[model samples]
Target: MKATIRWAGDVKFEAESGSGHTVTIDGPPDHGGKNQGVRPMELMLLGVGGCSSFDVMHILKKSRQDVTGCVAEVEAERVDEVPAVFKSIHLHFIVTGRALKEAQVKRAVELSAEKYCSASIMLGKAGVDITHSYEIHEAAE
Candidate 1:
């Protein structure tokens, strides 16, 4: 996995992944940026969310759950000190399916946080205090 970030002038950058995808990143207006795109920290949070969400959906599919939709909402807290590192992170998943089993959803979330999701594991190892919860909704007929 490789990516390149090029400075696009005044606290802005264009990042291109090895897979030929691109994203624009910029700082806030108070930080000499035009706020043209997502902040770097926000991207980090999204990465974790995406990684975990993918794992949950994959696990559910493998378990033969009639999954229809999955959404992950990620929230984080940062320290006020220098570096402003993540203090805590939480992921709330809304899972929709036909008669989704609570135990299956719970186990999937546990597996992602404890074993599968690389992003969450990395942050937890670095003392980020990651946590997760999920809600299962019955799919409409």
Candidate 2:
């Protein structure tokens, strides 16, 4: 729950989580940065995707679904003014499994978006429009 951000230079930073993981954050070249790493907003979008994906996978596993792989594609829009913030966010999940039940997958996605994904829910409550969708793919034989 704790993290530290150290200035690396103009528009660049090194962020270390309490767990000891680190990431480089920087702005684009035009923004006085060399584009060395992910932007802060990009990281936020990824966080939302990660949180929701974790819930979806956990729920599907506990339900005994034969999942083989999964991917969460996150997209977001920002307000067009100073202190620009997230205007909307969308998560598209691609799930692959063997004989995966559509109902089960749908349930998992719904559960994550409506109940389990804290990050997305928090953003939603903050007036950011949030949405979710999913697709299923059969594993190759």
Give candidate 1's TM-score. 0.98
**lDDT for each candidate structure:** 0.97, 0.96
Error of 2 at 121 (Å): 0.4
Most lDDT-accurate candidate: 1
Q: Model 2, range 1-141, lDDT digits (tens) per residue? A: 899999998999999999999999999999999999999999999999999999999999999999999999999999999889999999999999999999999999999999999999999999999998999999999
Error of 2 at 45 (Å): 0.2
- Residue-by-residue lDDT tens digits, candidate 1, 1-141: 999999999999999999999999999999999999899999999999999999999999999999999999999999999999999999999999998999999999999999999999999999999999999999999
Q: After superposing candidate 2 on the true structure, give the runs of residues whose Cα lies further than 4 Å from its correct spot.
A: none
lDDT, candidate 1, at 87: 100
Q: Model 2 lDDT vs. the true structure?
A: 0.96
RMSD of each: 0.6, 0.7
Stretches > 4 Å off in candidate 1: none
Which residue pairs of candidate 1 clash?
A: none
Cα lDDT, model 1, residue 42 = 97
